[model samples]
Target: MAVIPVAIAGAPYEVRIKAGILAQAGRHCRPFVRKNRVAVVTDEHVAAKWRATVEASLAGEGIASQWLVLPAGEATKSWAHLAQTVDFLLGQEVERKDNVIALGGGVIGDLTGFAASMVKRGCGFIQMPTTLLAQVDSSVGGKTAINTPMGKNLVGAFHQPSLVLADPLALDTLPLRDTRAGYAEVVKYGLIDDAEFFEWCEANGEKLLAGDAQAREYAIARSVAAKARIVAQDEKETTGVRALLNLGHTFGHALEAETGFSDRLLHGEGVALGMVLAARFSARQGLMHGQDAERVVRHIGAVGLPASLRALGLDCDGRRLADHMLHDKKMDAGTLPFLLMRGIGQTFLAKDVDLGEVAAFLDEELAA
Candidate 1:
């Protein structure tokens, strides 16, 4: 097991990455689970597939649990589901001291984490992220959120989990498409700042996607460690240091909004393409080498991820897409910052971005 500690203000937690760790969840979580009983919030898909294993794991250590299984999908992160989950936890007699276990992917983690943050003022929760997306990115960061009518993640909180158990085995059940999408985030950490790691990913990305256990574990550990270091420096993103993690998120969130946050374009797929756009835009702006930008796009495409807006066939123009970015949660005082690359593994926050120029760039990209 590889354990990475995230030291954030007010709360600190550990993200444990290992294969077949779900069975050990009970023993691993006993210390933080104040009550012998835990309320597990999961999605229907995950419950149908892995709930038995998770329940049995908890039961092994005399930890009884009540389950609040919800419908799976991006839509589950809504006000209605939030209320339903909180009500279910209340009915389960979940106290502030009791830990609420999030037993699914990003949807479950965000919804459950937001619910835990609000219920009884605040409560503890453990993350048992099943999907590759959750294991690497969403589970480590305290940025739990639900999409709103306005945009993705417009409503949420920063409630750190007590512990995070990312079992690569759970990913065995993940579809190849989802695995590839999740690989985008793993590659993201490398793109944000670690040139050597980026090179490693370039070489091993195919193997990782092909289910090489050694490669998967190594990638997860590296990604988690990178995020842990950034979160420790800027937990709430007050300082600009942590914003580097959003290397592709600004453009990616806009793509997500354009796709209605649906499966039409998975979040990581959007990020994959978004990172390419960021790289290309940086090159266009003379900040990065053109070949370097092409390399980023090529690698993302090589892994079967979308690397261009033209491929998505969205029925919108640059101005329309740029409008969506105005709703991004990262917007501050009506000013949006773009994470632009100076080169591979060299990204910087560019607050001087002109939305008009961005629209023009998107127009060119869409025309491509």
Candidate 2:
């Protein structure tokens, strides 16, 4: 088992990664789950797979388990769904002292954590992420939210889970597409801070994707460590530091909006394509070389992730995408800052940029 500690300002947490950790959840959760009743918040998909193990564990700890299954998709992470989840918790007599455990992918984690954060003003949240995406990225950070019609993650709170239990065994059930999408974030940790890690990913991503045990554990631990450091520095995203974490999300979320945020465009795939565009745009501005852009695109494509602007199939051009970015929740004072790169393992947000130039550049890229 790999125990990764997340030293954040509000709370110091840990992510436990192991092969059979799901079966040992009760032992791990013994401290926080004092109340007799615990809600296992999961989606239909995950509930189908790991319900037996989770329920058995909680039951062994003398905690009654209530399985609250939501629909499995980004659309379910909304105010209405969240309201329903809170209602379930209330109906189950889930007191604030008791804990709510999220047992699925990012969608389930985000929705359950948000509900747990709101109901009775606060409750405990434990992440039992089942997907590669959740294990590597979303499960660590406290950023929990549901999408609004205007944009993604518009309504949410910073609610950190008391514990994060990442069972790599759970990811075995993930679809190939979802697994590849999750890798995009794993690669991002390298791009944003560590060149050595990035190269390691380039060398071993194939084995990791093939479900090699050591590869999975190493990638999850390293990715968690990278995110832990970032969150510790800037928990609320007020400083420019946390925003770097959204390296491709600004463009990626807009693309998701255009696609109705469905299976038509998975979140991580959009991010993969978005990162490619960001790198090419940076190269175009002479901040980085074209080869760097190609390197990112090549590796991502090699992993079966989206590698080009055209692949997303959004009807709009770059100017239109830029316009959509204007609605991004990250915007402040009518100026949108972008995380642009100077080279590999290097990216920084530039706020002093003109939208017209960005729009023109997008138009040129679209025309090209």
**Separate clash counts for every candidate:** 0, 0
Name the lDDT value of residue 187 in candidate 2.
89
Clashing pairs in 2: none
Model 2, span 20-80: residue lDDT tens? 9999988888888877778888888888899999888888988778888888888898888
The clash tally of candidate 1 reads: 0
Q: After superposition, how far is residue 18 of candidate 1 from its true place, in Å?
A: 1.3
The TM-score obtained by model 2 is 0.97
lDDT of 1: 0.91
Which ranges in model 1 have alpha carbons more than 4 Å from their true place? none
Query: Candidate 1, residues 208-299: lDDT per residue as tens digits?
Result: 99999999999999999999999899988998988998878888989998998899999899889999999999999999999999999899
Clashes of 2: 0
